[model samples]
Target: MQIDIRAKGFELSPALREHAERRLGFALSWAVYDVRKVAVRLYDINGPRGGEDKCCRIQIALPGTSDVVIEDTEADLYIAINRAVDRAERSLARRLERQREHRHARQPVVEITDDDSAEEFEQRADAGVFH
Candidate 1:
């Protein structure tokens, strides 16, 4: 998946950007085929005066399905990113699983009828065809 990372209210360091990308990539590795893109935004809510005001927002795009968005805030940006990624992983799993179940539920179920061929097959089976 394509991942884009950006920061607000502060400069985004290479280390931070790399951290976000690595964490997100590993977390969603199982969904490579299903995921189209990932967008991450980090915010320093407290600015110079810090006090548990870091925010991490992640939006995941899935082809042919609704997007998933997850957000978390913590005293440290790393913590926020970790928490948000965890939440996104669980939410994405549930959404994809539900889609799979829905597709299966929509499939038509075939039924057997009392046709001549079916009757003949049944008779042969009753006679133990090979016995």
Candidate 2:
């Protein structure tokens, strides 16, 4: 998967960049096959005046599904990045699970037997037992 990291309102240091990359790589490894790209944006919301203004936004692009976007804010940028990655992981898992369930719920195929007639097939099709 491709990862793009961006920093806003501050210069991004090598240590911080490496930390974010490592954390995200580990966190998203489970859904690596499903993920196409990841975009991470780190923001210093309050600039020099620090509060709970560190924001991390993570956007995951998944195949055949809508992108999952997660945002978290904390006093520490590392904590915000961690929380956002965790949330993104959970969101991607849930979406994949739902898609799997939907796919498995499709109508089953029907095999014609000598004893079965056209009327039987029609009835079964109407009742959604056959597709």
Find the candidate with the highest lDDT and give its number: 1
Least accurate 10 contiguous residues by lDDT in model 2: 107-116
Q: What would the per-residue lDDT of candidate 2 be over residues 1-131, giving only the tens digit for each residue?
A: 99999999999999989999999899889888888999999999999998999999999988887899999999999999988988988888899999899988884767778887899988987887753
RMSD to true structure for each model, in Å: 7.3, 4.3
Q: What shift in Å separates residue 20 of candidate 2 from its native position after superposition? A: 1.1
For candidate 1, write residues 28-98 as lDDT tens digits.
Answer: 99999999999999999989998999999999999788799999999999999999999999999999999
**Model 1 C-alpha lDDT versus the unseen true structure:** 0.91
Instruction: Provide the TM-score for each candidate, comma-separated.
Output: 0.82, 0.81
Model 1 misplaced stretches (Cα beyond 4 Å): 111-131
Q: So what's the TM-score on candidate 2?
A: 0.81
